[model samples]
Target: MGTITALGLLLLICMVVVGGTQGLQAWISLIFNFAALFFAMVLMAFHLSPVLVTLVTGVIVLAMTIFLGGNDSNSTMVAFYASVAVLILLVILIIPIEHWAQIQGFGQEDSEDLEGMSTILGISYLNVAVSTAILSTLGAIAEAAIAIAAGLAEILEQHPKITLKNLQGAGFKVGSQIIGTTFNTLFFGFFGGFLALFIWFAGVHYSLGEILNDKILVGEVLMVLFSMMSVIATIPLTTWAMVASERQARKKFVK
Candidate 1:
């Protein structure tokens, strides 16, 4: 069997064993997430604006990861809105920061990798850099939003009479618990993802300064920082969104 097929079958088996029907839905949503990303790349290749592609992909991925990941409508809506709000704010911050950082385009070290590519492709590497930052951080932002929303929702469900002030406190407490592991997840995930690249740097006798100043390295580090910031922003925003949503629901039910 092909490697991808084998992996898919394994995922199916594991999901069935772990969560049964819910796991199946999760798997389907995961598949849709990959499809959405693939579609976004194809669109980018066809000269579509990378910013638009990133925005659309973010929406699609958020929908699949929240709605199809077995979340209720309320939770999904909270996740979606919170994520979008945080992403917009992050994008605004990323624009000036990325420009100031001056890490766009290929570095001299990367010239070896782009030997024959024509500059006539007309692609704006700066825009591409911004898009890459957005896309890279998006998954973490979505995950953090969904997690915070779901946690707050559960807290509300368990303590239906909790006041907004108390709920916000509880949300912060819950967020504190999640933040540590979430940050570690991002940290270790980066380490694992770039382990081979790090090895290559060491193999090539790259100096510390060279490694630090490398364009790809700087870009990736910036992406990680951006993702971390998004995840941090997501916690409070999601909590506030859930609290606001709950308040609205309560006011409506009283009428």
Candidate 2:
């Protein structure tokens, strides 16, 4: 087997062993998510509006990741709703940011790779950049939403009569706990993925301004920043969603 295949099998084995049935479902959801992303790319290649495709694909990915992977309906719904909210908000922000940054298309580093290839694909690179930024934030938003929602769901189960104010407090507390780790995960993942690029920058002795303005570097940085913002937004959004749900449920009970 190829290295990737082998590693994938190992991961599957570990998940199955550790997580049991839930792990298997999570793994299946991952496969579905991969298919969704592939289909999205195919649609984009066919010249569909990338932003629309991304928005649709993102919802699909989040559905599979949350609903299929988790057994709890309440938490999954909250996460899905909050994630979509964050996704929509980020899309609004990314389009203008991508346009303003003008970091779309290949950078100088990609020049060698595209020497003879046509850079004209007929699609706006800005849209693609916006899509990239939007897609990058989805995972973080979903994760944070899930974490807070699930934590609040558990609190509801335990306390059963926890006040809305206390529930909101719990949500904020859960969000604060995860924020640091999530930030670190994004930071380290970015740093590790771009370590070679950083070394190249250092070796070439790029000035501070040049490095700051580098298309590749700036694009990655902006994506990370967007993701952080989404995670931050997801916390309160998910909290409010859960609180609203509780309030609605209480009203039904009173009736």
TM-score per candidate, chains pooled: 0.92, 0.97
Model 1 global lDDT (CA atoms, 0 to 1): 0.84
Candidate 2 CA-lDDT value: 0.88
The sequence of per-residue lDDT tens digits that candidate 2 reaches over residues 1-255 is 899889878888999999998888888887787788788878888999999999999998888788866668988898899888888888888888888999988899878889889877988878888888887777777778888989999999999988899999999999999999999998987788999899999999999999999999999999889989888999999999999989999999999
Q: Report, for every candidate in turn, its global Cα lDDT versus the true structure.
A: 0.84, 0.88
Weakest 10 consecutive residues of candidate 1 by summed lDDT: 63-72
Q: Which candidate number has the best lDDT?
A: 2
Candidate 2 off by > 4 Å: none
lDDT of 1 by residue, 1-255 (tens): 999999998998899899988899888987888888788878887889988788878877777777776457897798889989998898899889888887887777677778988767677778778888887887798888888888888888898999999998987888898889988888888778988778879899999999998887888788888989999899899899998999999999999
State the displacement of the C-alpha of residue 9, model 1, in Å, after optimal TM-score superposition: 1.9
Clashes of each: 0, 0
